[model samples]
Target: MNTVTRAHLCEAVYQEVGLSRNESSALVESILAEICDELVAGHTVKISSFGTFSVREKGGRIGRNPKTGEEVPIAPRRVLSFRASHVLKDHINHAPASGDNDADGTR
Candidate 1:
């Protein structure tokens, strides 16, 4: 699997905006920190055409252990959830332009 890291974002920003590597890294970190701060405050962060990130409160529940067949209490916690926007979903579902040709190289 291909995973993108902060470095990847920093590089992209640096290439696109002609910013120094350090500045690009700082920009990426600041944006991420802002998103996290809002989520921690129980606010949704919505980036149009991207997705929405929100925190949900889960109630404590009893769950059974498969191996021991014993009931266990599951502690409740706040979980972060992301819902992709329609544009983002469509982008993911479509094939890239480079993949549109047949094996014979016909467009």
Candidate 2:
């Protein structure tokens, strides 16, 4: 399994867009910062063909402690969640599996 990082995104942008490494990094950072800022401001962000990001508020609840069989209170708080768009889901579902070749036998 592999995880994509900010550095990977920057490198991709630099290669595909012919931007300097620093500029690519800055662009990625700026876009992420804007998303974060909007979420922090209680706004939902929807990117076409990608997904939607929003904050959800969960109510406080009583949870049990398994070790001592004690009950504990869970605080209410906001959580960030993502719902992938149908376009993204379809793309992922139709994508080639790991180690599999494409239709043209290309990786």
Candidate 3:
């Protein structure tokens, strides 16, 4: 139920890479900016063992208003989506929960 922020990522990099806080922050920011730029340029971004980020084009359609029962036109737009890789999915699915024991009953 916790959210991971850019600061969290920067801190993680700083801790794991022996980088200064400012350098870690800049590195994380640079990577995120590159990903955003690629997506904005209509290119898909794929990270091995992580996930793929892509933009999808959706056609305009008619939608109904829930309150007044009126029909409305919905504009066509591009949406960003993420598809997790199998490695990532398996890791998430098999990850041990807090306070849980392993198969051999060792925490």
Candidate 4:
């Protein structure tokens, strides 16, 4: 699988919206920063047709270490989680498959 980075998103925005490269990059960064700020404030961020990002609190617990068979104390921390929206799930589930499958295994 290929990874999509901020640069890729900026390029896409530049192409689709006719923005300059730097402008697209700044736009992407601004949106990301907003989302992060909300999440850090313990608020959920809901993006239409995409997903929801939320921060979850995890309680401290005892955990066992593998290989050493030692008991370890797990520190409690906040974790970020994402839940795909129904629209996103539907889109992903119904996406058309790339025509990369052939009986001869050649595209």
State which candidate has the highest TM-score: 1
Task: Give the Cα-based TM-score of candidate 3 against the true structure.
Answer: 0.84
Tens-digit per-residue lDDT, 10-36, candidate 4: 877888898899999999999999999
Cα-based TM-score, every candidate: 0.86, 0.84, 0.84, 0.84
Model 3: lDDT of residue 13:
88
Q: After superposition, how far is residue 36 of candidate 3 from its true place, in Å?
A: 0.5
Candidate 2 local distance difference test against the native:
0.88
Error of 4 at 67 (Å): 2.4
Off by over 4 Å in 2: 97-107
> What value does the lDDT take at residue 29 in candidate 3?
97
Order of the predicted models by lDDT, top scorer first: 1, 3, 2, 4
Off by over 4 Å in 3: 97-107
Least accurate 10 contiguous residues by lDDT in model 2: 98-107
Per-residue error at 63 for model 3, in Å?
1.3
Candidate 1 TM-score, C-alpha based: 0.86
Q: Name the candidate that leads on lDDT.
A: 1
Candidate 3 on 1-107: residue-level lDDT in tens?
44668977887788789889999999999999999999999899999999999999999999999999999999999999999999999988895766444333321
Off by over 4 Å in 1: 99-107
14: Cα error in model 2, Å:
0.3
